[model samples]
Structures are given as structure tokens and as C-alpha cells.
Target chain A: MANSKRTLAALVYNRPGVLNRVASLFRRRGFNIESIAVGRTDDPKLSRMTIVVIGDNATVEQVRKQLDKIVDVVKIIDITGDDMVSRELALVRVKATTATRAEIVQMVNIFRGAIIDVGSNTLVIEVTGDEDKIDSLLNLLRSYGIREVARTGRVAMTRGGTIGSIKAEEEAATGRQR
Target chain B: MKLSGARMLCQALINEGVDVIFGFPGGSVLPLYDVLPEFQGLRHILVRHEQGAAHAADGYARATGKVGVCLATSGPGATNLVTGIANAHLDSSPVVAITGQVARAFIGKDAFQEVDITGITLPITKHNYLIMNASDIGSVVKEAFHLARTGRPGPVLLDIPRDVFVEEAEFNYPDKVELTGYKPIHQGHPAQIKRAAELINSSECPVIIAGRGIIISDACEQLRELVEKSQIPVATTLLGMGGFPGTHVLSLGMLGMHGTAYANMAIQNSDLVICLGSRFDDRATGKVSAFAPAAKIVHVDIDAAEIGKNVRVDVPIVGDLKVVLQVLNTLVNSKSRPAWLEQIQKYQREHPLCVSSEEDKLLPQHVISQIYELTGGDATIVTGVGQNQMWCAQHFLYTRPKTLISSGGLGTMGFELPAAIGAKVGCPKETVWCIAGDGGFQMTMQELATAVQDKVAVKIAILNNGYLGMVRQWQELFYDKRYVGTPLWSPDFVKIAEAYGIPACRVKNKKDVSAAITTALSYDGSYLIDFMVEPEENVYPMVPPGASLAELMEHPDARRANASSTFTVSNV
Candidate 1:
């Protein structure tokens, strides 16, 4: 089967070396990670990680299982091809001449992006959207010579309220349930 | 209470119920050595080398089902433990390795005797930690033990800087670990268990391939119940020898590359393969494309990654084998397949493993059989990697769980002696035997001093063939009899044992083998016996690499004569 993109969110303990544990697993398994983003969750002790990978269903399922094996990982949910809200933040620095600045700003405005910084011959545009919208915006700015691009890989959650909160609560209810 | 980091480490180990540790002291771990005398509860076995310490700990863990502890210093000390750590990891042995690093300030400066021990061990360990502060010692130690012993047990590492050991801090051990991500699933899904049961009950030809998980999960009884209830034949992986009684009527012995011909035939002909906790390693399943072609495989393992990593599993149940088997035993119906049994008998009759009746010279198989006869297959046999391990696995019968403690997955040579010491220490009353090849015994022979010093009464059996027997067999079979780098020279093992202040003997004749074993068994303390056996002997029923299990060659010449005969007359 052809490989498809898979976006998975994991709630982990906010402890040092936890990220290394997760990252090392992927490196050790030789899994190609497209993008990853980590940030503190609503709970102070918990951190949420969004990881995008490209693989077949079996490969993605294996990645999910391997991630769950890490001691610091709390919960993992795959939101691929589901009714979910997904977004990616990209900071693109384009080589903007005076002639292309107005056109680039109009394109960014149309894509609902913002101008984060302005330089003599460059404009840093910040855009947050699904991968498709971000790709479309970046494609339009590519003609203006994109200097550099930084993206916080896709983060996703189910559209109908919290998907993992109930699971986490049930997991907590069973102390060392094995 | 305020305590130094070294004191905190000792207390934390004590809290985790660690009574003994195998270690070799070095420059970086001097702080730990200095404070070691203060703790009365923990006994330290000083090993000759860092690698010996790790293997000994691994052996202890495999024998006792407890997290074995080993300590080493930084840099070279930590580096030397890599092979043993990897051995434990591959074999699923629970071992906690602690190493001392350079002072905190000099960690990244390439200070003397400093190494990134954590980074070196990251891939091999289940998990690892580098302690920057003394206060974290308790929690780290707790977590390290927890991780090492829990769900698909493996080795864990803890690298502590020297400064952390000297720095004083208030000690508070956490009462509970709150790792949200570390839960191992123990219960099989009800639907999956039912499906497995249905497959088991309905299949006409069912075979069970048991693995090390049976011993690790303490599921031998459950496995036996399921097998007997379902009337399924059982074939064990190398490490899974004692999981099912080898003497049972339904037992097909070890299955794999050098597996019994009958066992391989059973697997090839079965309709359903119930893989309980055994990963279908390449050695076990030669040419996966042609392995068990007629069977629908049902794999039950604790680690989800092992399910479809090698062979595709039809019904995958990810959970503890004990729990899964318990549920399966209830769901399975008691029934017998007379036709299946008759077919297995036919295979067994056609390809019987024959031992030479002529006894002019000693044979390795005779020695193992004599050991089995004398011990009644009750002794815990630990073997170093080689033809000796294969002979022991094929000849000796294991009826008890955790009785055959060999390095299986890693095929690590030099594992038997130190591991025997650890096994003896772990199970003090059991008769522990270290069956090793002459080449492998010489690798860690220095550990004989540790065995004598610790007063561990482990009997040593060296199958002295004067060559790296297994490699010699391969060279003869595959490399056109070019015996390059296979011949070995060794120190007089009897003299070496005597130098260690232990009683020793040598058996050159076939008739003296039993007497020598009896003498070693009757001796009160440690004993070593070097059995001079035939050098040119080779393990048979080997499915050459990448060949189907159905194409097992009983001997090198048989492969050519029977190349086209899939089910023909056996050479034996």
C-alpha cells in the first residue's frame, strides 16, 4: 500500500528526558518523522506532543504502539482521516522586493496569515492553518523566493470535544493497571 | 533526613529490596566504594571485569525473576558493560546497571574517566537516567527498578556524576510512580481471546510454539493447561525449553534452525500455530515465506511491536501470556485429534535422532545425557553459546520452569561461568551447572575466582573439543572444510580450577563421564570437570539459512543426497 500522512497526538509527563525518550524511539526504529511539536497541556504536569509521520496503516499502528511503550508517554490518539481540527504554524521568510511586497501582503491577507516581521529585502510571514492551506500559501510565496521556512508540525484534536481526557481519567483510576 | 548522594543510593537500593549487587570498582565510582562499607544489608560480589558483573547480574535476574543489579565506573567501565546490557535486553532479563560519572562540572569537558554512559546505553536499556542531583536518586532508583522489572522486562541504566554522590540533600522516596505513559496491557481483549479459542478448538492440526515469555510471566502451568485442554502439540523456542516439559508426550522439543526434525515437521504441517509469547525469530522460522504455510498464526505477546514485526500474525493478542492463557484455558474445549497425533508419531518414527552406540571415544551428547540421567533433569543448566548449548538443549530434558538458563537471543559466548555463579547465588539450594565450550569458557574464565570467593557451589562442565565447535561445524559444512580461525588453544582447565582453590577433574574416556559428573555433584563446594569429547561432531537437523523448515538437513552430506526429497528417509 502507498504511504499516507498520519497525525498523532500524545499526552506525556512533563519531565526532563521524556522528549528524548520519544525522539530516540523514532530514531532507533528508523521511523521517518515528518514533523513534531511539543507544549505544556492544560494540566501542568502533562505535556502534549503532536507528531506527523508518513507510512502505511501497519507502519502507523506500529509507531503508535511503540510510542505507547515509552514510560513518559500517557496517551496517544491518531486523528488522521477523522473529523478533527488540525493546524500547523509556519514562519516563512520570503525575499520581498518593493514590487512584490504589496502582492505578497495581499496573498497573506487572503490566506488569513499575518506579517510577523519586515526586513529590508525580506518579509517574515506567519501562517496557521491545515497543511493544505499552509502549503498553498507557501507555494504562492515560493515565486517571490522563500529565504527560509520554520513550521510547528501539525497538531490535531477530535472535533467533538476532548478525545483523550476521558481515557486519561480512566487510566488514572486504575493505578498501575497491567 | 540529610544524606550524601552515595548514602541515598544505598538507601534507595535497599528500599527497592536489593540485597546483592555484582560490580567491579573503578576510579569514577570511588565515592560509592568509600560509602559501601556503611551499608550492612547489601552484599557486593566483586567481579574480575565489568562485563562479568553485567552477565552475572543478568544470570541472577533470569534465575530469580528479580531485577538484577550491577555497578560499574565511568568511561571504560561503563563501555565494557555494553555487550552484557545488550544481552540482557535481547533476552528480556531485568537488570539495573548503575555507573559513576565524572564530577558534574567536568561532564561535558571530557574529564578523566568520564563518558556519556547514558547515551551509550540508550538503545540497549528499557530506560535510563542521568542523575544531576543527589535528591533525585531515590526516585530514579525507584523508577529504574520499576521499569526494569515491569512488562517485557529489560535492562535499565543509571549514570550518576561523582559530584552528585558527594553532594548532601534531603532524601524523600516517592511512594508511588505517576508515569502516565508506562502502563503495559495485561488483559487480552475478550473478543480476541474468543477468536483464539475458536481457532484452537476448530483446528484439526494445532501446534503451540512457546517462548521465554512463559518463564518470564510465570505462565508455565497456564500453558500446560491450555495445551493439555486443547490436546495441542507444543514446540519450544531455545529459551523456552523448560516452559513446557520436554519429557511430555505432546512435547516436540526445541524448534528452529537446529531444532528437532520432528518439531520442524510438526510446525510445517500444522493447521494452526499458537505462538505464545515467542517472537518468530529468523532462526526459529527459517524462510518465513515458507514457514508454517498451512497454519493460521495466533500471536500472543506483551510487546505490541513483536506481533507483526517478523511473521504476519492472523490473530494478534497483545497482553501478558499468563493472563491471556488463563482466559484462553477457560474458553478452549478439551478435545483430542487422533489423526494429528498419529501424523506426529509417523514423523517422529521416520526421523529419529540417533546417538551412536559405539563408545570408544567420548561424545558431547553422551555427557549431556549422563547429566540428565544423574540429575533426573532437575538441575538448572546454563550453557555458553556453541554446539554444547545445542547438544544440551537436544539431549537434556527440562521439566521445571526457569531451569535452562542460557543466553538465547544474543547467542553470547562467555555467558555460562559468571551466569552460573549468579544463578547459584540466586537459587542457593538448586544444583546449577555451567555447560560451556572450550573456546567460550576461556573468554570469562577469570570469573572462576569470583565463584570461589563468593563460595557459590556451581558445577562447571567444559565440553573440551579443542575447537570453536559450532564455528568449526559451519566452516566444514559451508566453507569447504577450510578450518581457518576455528582451532583453539586453551589453558589446562583442571589446573586453572585448582588455582582458584576449587576441586577439579578431567574425563578423557567415555566411561568416566558419569563418574566425573557424580563426583562434581557429590562435592560440597564448587567443582569443574573438563570432558574431552570428539572434535568433529556437529549439530544435526539444521535448516540451512533461508531454507524452509521442511528442508531440514540431518547432516551435511544428507543435504545433497536428499536435496529434492521433501519427506524422505532420514540419515539417522
Candidate 2:
């Protein structure tokens, strides 16, 4: 069977060794991660990490169970196939000539990409999309001599609502009340 | 000798033999962070969340059979540890969780960043303390560890206020702890032991049910000796999986939901039931009045409260399992095997609770049986919650204590991986197999790397059924199969395990089980085996909720209509 991966967005407290502890837990339990995006949450006290992992039903549940036990975690959500606005931002520097620049610009406009910076012979373009879209766009840009690419793994939210942050705050409020 | 309460607390933990602590730092605990550098020998792991810290500590405790420690600051930090603490309490794991509070002056004042951790965790922990005085800190710290590790091991919390840390106090550490309400009976009365043996000798057919207490008491050897001397067959609760090696002639595997047909049949047929170190959990006893209807019961346990808490006991002996077993073993005369064994064996052959067959595609039983076959009845197996744990108790042959690590009393789903890590750490040479369902494994999946990083070499087997299998079963049988909130669409496991540098495999058919097991067995580092099995299969021989044991719905093929109304089967 063809194998695939899933990503998880973990909202956790920003503290020392939090990443190591979470990483170590994943290593010990044997869950596999494809990519991880960690940055600041709305509250400066907490940090958010988007983890893309691969597992069958059993593997995913195992990850959920273990993650639930983590004390620093405010909330954990799996947005693998749910209806959601999922995007990753990547900056790629590709070699370009005047002849290629017009074509590149057309391709960028087609995918709604932005030309962030232009070097003498290299153009740094920023694109945001689902993982598959990014992969395809990267593939198209590869032919133009791709130099270096820095991609944000993934950041996701359910299409119509704000569930993660709200649930986390509710839990915090309930915890305080207790 | 000025110190933050957090620093002194860390020093106290170090004194208590705590080598590692899992927690998160926050506004309420910044003072401790500043002084953390001085505690050079103590290793602190900052968890991504407070809840993870609690679970890691619980995992550490279950694995090593020692007290695990977790820490967090006030409010949300303390609250995050609640689930982990509750999980430990359910599983009877020994863990210590310490959290910072707002200054004691503001305890009930609703100070900024303040939360009443003690009040919230009271029901979950064995004991909890709110430290208002710096002088009381030394004693409270000592008491927390003592309470957590003693008696029926469980989590204990110590909530330290911010001001207490900076205050000066005499460095007096009491040499002992004394609690009036906490006296645990460790030795059974001689008269009671004699009476228990007398009942055993006189009964036409007697059966023994052992639980985790045997393992906790380190009395597996004694239990084996007693079982052999008396020629009594033994059945265990889910937590008691490794308490008796299932290879013994008298071992009747697990009893109760998803239990062996023979074990439940034996319980039904016996005249006298001798229960040791095991509580009569609703899952085990199944409709109390209907359970062991013909049997006169003798219950032995260290916890007095557990006695008569579930099932009525003819005789209750409260004490340490080892001491009680030793006394009982010496008192009971060497007796011949009861004819009941023959009848149970006949039932075993007739009903035989085997889950694998050519007729079914990939079943959970097939994968479990293959793992059992490959291990050859010698490996230590750990389980997470739900059907997978019941399956191990039913199928895997447990030969010794610590062999089958599971969160039984607490039924915490994510316990297997961390427990297996601790077990491997305690016994490095022994192979530890962690078996879990999709729901259970995900609870503590974060601990996977700890196994790899520590070179724990634990093997993981995931039985994937694409749902919260256990709850889904309950919903199907009792709640009209609405199947609300149970569906699980999963990601491919192989690629994920590989990313963390662990060997991984996926098995979708029965034919692939052996190969998957072989690959996991041979891999030098940690390995993950994902076995995709049939969903919608419920654990049978179920005594419908609130129904008596006699009212069990046994064998779907032989399910009696109106089974919950009576003990007798008219047709049979």
C-alpha cells in the first residue's frame, strides 16, 4: 500500500526543554513526524507547533494518548483530512534571466505567489498553499534552477471556526476555577 | 541561605532520589528557573505542555516501578497536570506532581495566575498538600513521596506558594512519616488465613483470581507455588496479566470482558472463589449477584476499602499479598486437582476463545496471536487501554510479574509506551513489547522518542481499527450504534516512524502479520508495527452494564434471548 503522512498542530506553553520533552516522547512511543512548524501563539506565554506525522489508526491514537499526558500542552488537534484552511509559507531563490522572469511572474500570478526579493540573477519568491500545492509549485520552479528554499512546515485552522484557541482557553479557565 | 520555593523544592526532590523531572516553566515559576543551574546533577525536561509532563512521569513510574515526578507553575500549568494525575490514579502508578501557586497570602483571594490545584486534584491523588509555610515544605515533600510510593501506589500533589520558597526555615528533614488514616495492613490475621485454607480444602471446586497486587507485593513466585500446591486454576484481571505465567497448567488466562471463554466459564462453574490482590471491578465481576452464584468467596487485599466495595465477600483478609500468600501457602495442605479443572478444560475445548481463522480477514486476535507465537511465551508484553489490553490478558501467556505491564486499575489508555520504556530501563536485557489500540496509543505517543533516545529498544505494535474501538463497542451494543465521535481516519505509520529513525512496517492482511513481527523483532533500534485489523468487532462474553454476572451475553453464536434476566439458559 502507498504510505502517506499527517500533520498535527500542538498549542503548548513556551518553556525550556518543552520541545525536547515532546520530541523524546514521540521517539519513545514510536510516532513518526514528517515536518514541524513551531511559533508564537496569540498569548505570548504559550507557543504553537504544527506537527506533520504519519501513522495508521492505532499509531495516531497512540500519539493522541501520549500527547494528552503532556503537562505543558494546552491543546492538540489533528487536521489531517478535516475541512480546514491549511497553508505553509516557503521562500525559494531560483536562478532567472529576463526571458524567464516574465514566465516566472505568470506562474506566480497563476498560483497567487509573490516575488519577495530579486537578486542579480536569482529571484526569491514566496508562496503559500497546502503541502501538495507547494510541492507541485516547487517542482515547476525546480526546472528554473532552484537554489535555496526555506519552507514553513504547516499552519492550519478549521474552515469556519476558531476551535483550537477557544478550547484551550476554556480548559485553562476551567483549570483555574478548579 | 535565601532560596526560591521552587529551588528548595528541586533540592528536596533530588534528595528523594529523583534524577529527572518533566515540567514546564511559567511566570509563577521563574524564580526556580533562575536557580535551576545550581542543581547540576538533576535533569529537568521541559514538556511541550503540563499534561505531557504528568504522563511522562507516570510512564517512568509504571516502567521502573518507582515514583515518577512532574512539575509545573500556577494556574494553567497546575491544571494541565490534572489529566496526567488522574491517569496515574486510575492505573495505580506512583507519581509526584509539584506545582507553584501564587503567594500563600493570596491563596483564596483569586490572585493573578492563581489556581487551587489541591482542591481540583483531591479526588485523583492519593494525597495532596498546599504548602503555606516554608518550614513545612521539607516534611510535606517527604510525605508526598512516601504516600505516592506506599500502599496502593498513586499520584500525590504538593502545591507550593511563591512566597514560601524565599522564606528561611530550619533544614530539619524528618526521618519518617506518620499518618493515622493511612495505615496500610501488611499482614493478614493467622486465623483468617486458616479459615481461608479451610474453605479451599472443603469446597468441591475452588478457583483463584489474582490481580496486580501480586505484582506490587513481589509475590508472583509465592503465588505460583501456592497455585501448584493447591492444584487450583488461576485467572487474572487485565492488570494481573503478568502476575501468573499463562503457560502453567492451571492458569486460565484473563477473566471478564474479552476474557477467555474457559476463564469466564470456570468462574461460572466454581463452588468457591479465592480472590487475591484483585478487586471485583465491574468489568471483572460482571453483574455481581449473578457472578460466582454458587461460590463462597475469600478476598485478600492490602486496601481495606476495596473489600466489599464491589462484590460481597464471605471472608476478607486485608494485608500485603506476599505475606498473605506465604501464610496461605504454608497453611493449605497439598491437594489433588479438583474435577472442576477437567470440566473447565472441556469447556475450553468446546468454546475455545481463539480469534484467528481463515474465515475472517485481518482480526485483532490474529495479529496478537502471531506476536504471542513469535515471542514464544517468554517476552514481557505491555498494553495500552481498551480491547487491546483485554486481548493481551486473554491471549498472551504471562509468566512473571512486571512481564505484562498495563494500566489496569486506572485504565489509562496511553500508558503502554512509557511503561514499556520504564520496564526496559529496569530490565534492559529483556525484550519489551508494547501493544496498543489506536485510541490508547495516541494518548502517550510523545514518549516514543524517549525510548529511542534512551536506547530502550522497546517494540511497538499498533492494532489499527480506525475508531475509538472500545467506546465504539459500548455504543454499538448498548447505545444503538449511533457511532457518534468514534470514527478515525488515520495517516500512514511507516513513513512517520522512519522520520524519527525507527524501523516501521504496516500489515493489512493475516499473511503479513508474521513478516511484520519478524521485521520488528530484528530491528536493532526501536520499531513500530502498524497492523490494520477489522473494525466493528465488539469484545464478547459481555455482562451488559448494570446486569449481574449470571446475565452475561456469551458467545454471539449462542447468545440467549433475554440473557440479562436470568442465569440459566433454557435451550442449553
TM-score for chain B of all predictions: 0.97, 0.89
Q: Of all true interface contacts, what fraction is found in model 1?
A: 0.68
* Candidate 2 lDDT score at position A82: 74
The lDDT leader among the candidates is: 1
lDDT of each: 0.89, 0.77
DockQ score of each predicted structure, in the order shown: 0.53, 0.01
Listed in order, each prediction's TM-score against the native is 0.93, 0.70
Candidate 2 chain B weakest lDDT stretch, 10 residues: B563-572
Q: Candidate 2, which segments miss by more than 4 Å at Cα?
A: A1-178, B1-4, B33-37, B418-430, B443-457, B479-481, B499-501, B550-572
lDDT of 2 by residue, B1-572 (tens): 65556666777888888887777898777777777778986767665567767876876676567788888999999998888899888767799998889987887899888987877785577767778777777778888898888887889998888777677776546888744224567889888999999998788788889888887778899998988888888988877777887777788888876666678788888998999888888788877878988899999988765777678789889899999988889888888864777787776655555442334488786677778789786777888888887777666677767677777666777767766765665566888898989887777676776666656688999999999998998899889888999998766767767776788888888788998898888878689999888987666567678775556566564333222323221101
lDDT, candidate 1, A1-178, per-residue tens: 7889888888887878788878887787677889999988656777888888888888778778777777667777677877878889999999999999999999999999999999999999999999899999988888899999999988877787554563554357344342
